[model samples]
Target: MRLILPILFLTILSIKAFSREVASDSLANIARNAMFTDAYIQIEGKLHSKKLKVEVNLGDTPEQTKAGKEYSEKLTGKSHMLLS
Candidate 1:
């Protein structure tokens, strides 16, 4: 029914917002933990590179695609060393 759709939408939105907040808090904690410093940095770097990869693959925005290609080129030789 119409009421059912609205109720489901609201419930899903609330759960998504709550999870986003929790994930943000967890990321902050991970960044602050000295023991996790290296791991955190590595994970962050990989995430950035992966996002750039998606942009390069899509080639939707000219500016983003160009920047991503340049950035990825710079990482070509270094990624192997760092990721290892």
Candidate 2:
């Protein structure tokens, strides 16, 4: 009877552990999908009778210019770029 209790306890513990691992894996997958989501930046302007338009898919949301320059540099490896 003592052996049976220990075995059952261990079994239940292992099941809980497995369930937690599965939940962690699912959450990780959701985070990975969100990380890979697509974002964009579009610019349209006129320069002295010339019209210019630019569009780019950045794969992430744009931060404000003050906080975003670093992120843009990290994404493109370029300095002094505007993402918004």
Q: What lDDT tens digits, residue by residue, belong to model 1 across residues 39-62?
A: 111123464354322112324467
**TM-score of the candidate numbered 2?**
0.24
Give, for candidate 2, the lowest lDDT window spanning 10 residues. Answer: 72-81
Best by TM-score: 1
Error (Å) of candidate 1 at residue 38 is 22
lDDT tens per residue, model 2, 1-84: 879999999999989888833578888888888844354555455433234344555444345443445443444423333444
Could you tell me every candidate's TM-score relative to the true structure? 0.26, 0.24
lDDT score, residue 27, model 2?
85
Error of 1 at 66 (Å): 0.2
